[model samples]
Target: MVTPPSYESRQFERRPGIRPRQTLGRRLDAASRAALPAAIAVVLLLLLHAPLGLPAQPALLLGAELACVFYWSLFLPRVMPSPVVFVLGLLVDLLGTGPLGLSVVLLLIAHVAGIAWRQALMRQGALVIWLVFAGVAALCCLIEWLATMLLEWRLLPPGSAALQFGFALGEYLVLSGPFAWCMRVVARPHG
Candidate 1:
């Protein structure tokens, strides 16, 4: 007759002499990964309050846009949670003129799209990534314009939307490389 192994014997045999030190190291690594999004959020909030203005510009570059896209793509499955996206959008709406809740809704849509397409973009190069950022930025602009018109019942002229979209596309393209590099640096495994 064949005898079954004891529960204690089986458990010990599955993982022998795995020290608590190894477990602690893993926990620390996980904590480090989890901290990244919070760090990004704090930095973004600081930037929101910073005086990094471009004089004589009607439409200025906001760090929030870059922060949103970068954090969403880099930490899609973890850090950039839906609530964060919605809150970020609401914060942007409060800071800007386009109707309240408009930015929040637009951001939520963009974040959803980013999450859906993340895997496909991950394998591409920087230039392709920049192109993706441009597309997303354009979509954000479109959504904002649509939401404003729908809520306020004032049709924003096509020219205005085009101008705004152009400016955002340029801004996102300019910032994409730096943001992607920063995310890569942060995601690197520490020795």
Candidate 2:
């Protein structure tokens, strides 16, 4: 007859609390992943306010913010949480000349829209994504304009808002490629 090992010897619970430690590279990777969203937001802010002599309207800036939030939310929702989105929008509001909470609300809406449509959108091609983004940008601009009008208690001209919308949509096309590349570099998982 062969002797069997004791229960205590075989039980993993009996061992010391020697959990597997992550390697330094893995730790750094996780830290970078966590910081990436804010970093991207900051970069977008810088680009939005860069002294390029181009007029940086609230709509255009929000569109840039939308690109960041939208890309991250679609690709890495776990990294771009609601709180992060809110903070980024708040920072944009503080840094730019926009109504307080305007960026916050619009960005949050864009973030949520990204999350909601991510699955369907991800399956589609690049052109479809841009089309969808155009629709979201339009809706966000409309809501922003309406909110400003309601809060200010004055009828702002629709022409300027419409112009902003067109500029924002155009700007998105100009910026989306770089934004997507950044998203890939930041959100890519490490082995």
**Candidate 2 residue-wise lDDT at 138:** 86
Worst 10 residues of 1 by lDDT: 54-63
**Root-mean-square deviation of Cα positions for candidate 1 versus the true structure, in angstroms:** 8.4
lDDT of 2 by residue, 14-75 (tens): 66778456899878886787677768778868876877677544456777788778777876
Q: Using alpha carbons, what is the TM-score of model 1?
A: 0.66
Error of 2 at 117 (Å): 1.1
lDDT of 1 by residue, 1-191 (tens): 98686443466567856545558878787677656654565465456456667452334433345435454554344557677767766766676666787666666766776778777877887667667766766776677668768888877786666776677666666555555564567643321
Name the top lDDT candidate: 2
Clashes of 2: 0
TM-score of each: 0.66, 0.79
- Once all C-alphas are superposed, what RMSD does model 2 give against the true structure? 9.8
